[model samples]
Target: MEAKTAVNVGQLSRKPELKPKRKIKWKNVLTYAAFVGPALLFFVVIQIIPFLMGIYYSFTSWNGISAAVDWVGLENYKKIFTNDAKFFNSFWFTTRFMFAAVVISNLLGFGLALLLNGALKTRNILRTVFFMPNVIGGLLLGFIWQFIFVKGFASVGKYTDIGIFKLAWLGDEATAFWGIVIVFAWQTAGYMMVIYIAALQGVDQSLVEAARIDGASNWNVLTKIMMPLILPAFTICFFLTISMAFKIFDINISLTNGGPFNSTESVAINIYREAFQYNNFGLGTAKAVLFFVIVAVFTTVQVVMTKKKEVEA
Candidate 1:
């Protein structure tokens, strides 16, 4: 009995100890939930819910205020496709404006970047000056430019006797289109310039020096080496300009109010009028949906094409 008791004690002593697993702290999870919950709630309430509701309302003939909302089943879209002349015209105008604005803004921005990339004494100050216009709201900028076009240009023309400045810039259709382009480029080019300058600074200076040593001219160096290196910046700038120009509203409204027989009216302005002015919420929502599709497709195509060029480069 003594020997058996001793053996049992030894066995018990040799056995390894085991510990209980720790439970997950629900407090930490609650803390994270407390932090992230409100933002998610607001995003859903503000953006997602409204967007989904707009989609539903697009198929209904709701006047936006009354409780009566009759389902129309694509009638709004059908009217837009078959009978909306003003909307189509505005769409065409917007398309043309987008093309012009993108090209001019990118070119000017790139040029400014090149000029500022050099060691100029006043480049920093000039960059700040150029970018200042972008800080102002588009609506405010439009109003400011309106005064310049109406009074300031007239005053300058009166003194300098320049026929170009004397011409009715906002009153005529062709000139109004170009006028908007000029203001848009002026406002946006600075922002693009800042982007290009950053990209330009990232270019390999040794490659440029090697090209220079190989008897390459400045033009060739820019075209062959710098352009390829900075293609990504071009892609970004083009995308931004395209999106902004496509959905332009404030500047168009404050500048010309789509006057001169609504010649300079954009698709955005048309949608606003359709919804608020004419009280056609369903049609407006339908136009908005179509606008969204066009913008998505165009930007996607642009990004894909530019990305392919980037890989080739």
Candidate 2:
């Protein structure tokens, strides 16, 4: 009987050990929640709440200052779609700018990355100089460019009639659009170059050697081997370019203020004019909602397509 009792006691002790182990798992779960809960709470409170509020207000005729809110139910959207000439024009202009910026910025950044990736003196200093413009505030960049376009160019024009200095850049619609493109490319190229540089560094040295052994030229190795391997970088860069192009405002305002008779007014500038400047808060909010959908859709499509390409590559 005593032997049986000893065996039962041993079983009881083992059972308690297992129970503690189970309780420890719950403790780990609680600990993770404790660490993550604050950030999730902040995200919901600040970002999600405001986003939901913006969507709600878009369907209403709220002047943003008035207490009385009336539901207009897509009237603002209808106006933008059907009757707003300025909105349509701004949309086309911004789309064109987006395409131009993406292509020019990526090409220039990639070229710079290639050049700097080689063995050379002063490459690091050159990188810093190129990236300095990106660190400057967008509004500040705009103002600086405005001075260049309006005053600095004029002075240069008086001194020497050469190198695009004498052209009416901001005063003319065509020139203003290209001027914005050039400024944006200059500011962003350095950033893209850094991304490309990182990707280029990650490429396998052995693969390049193998391609060379097969009598492949430098161009063939770059296009056939290196490009495919760096697809993930391309995905990230493309998405950033698209989103930034869509949301660009401070630079647009500082550079041209959507001027030259609003010919260069981007969608972002147009939305601001509708809301704060014109006091059409509802319409502005509606435009904001539309803008959100457009950006979201574009980003989603690009990600899906590029992610597929990445997987295939």
Clash count per candidate: 0, 0
Off by over 4 Å in 1: 1-39
TM-score of each: 0.89, 0.89
Query: Model 1 shows how many backbone clashes?
Result: 0
Superposition TM-score, candidate 2 onto the true structure: 0.89
- Give lDDT tens digits, candidate 1, residues 1-313: 9999999999999968789889989999899989999999999999999989889989999998899999999999999999999999999999999999999999999999999999999999999999999999999999999999999999999999999989899999999999999999999999999999999999999999999999999999999999999999999999999999999999999999997799999999999999999999999999998899999999999999999999999
Q: Which ten residues in a row have the lowest lDDT in candidate 2?
A: 15-24
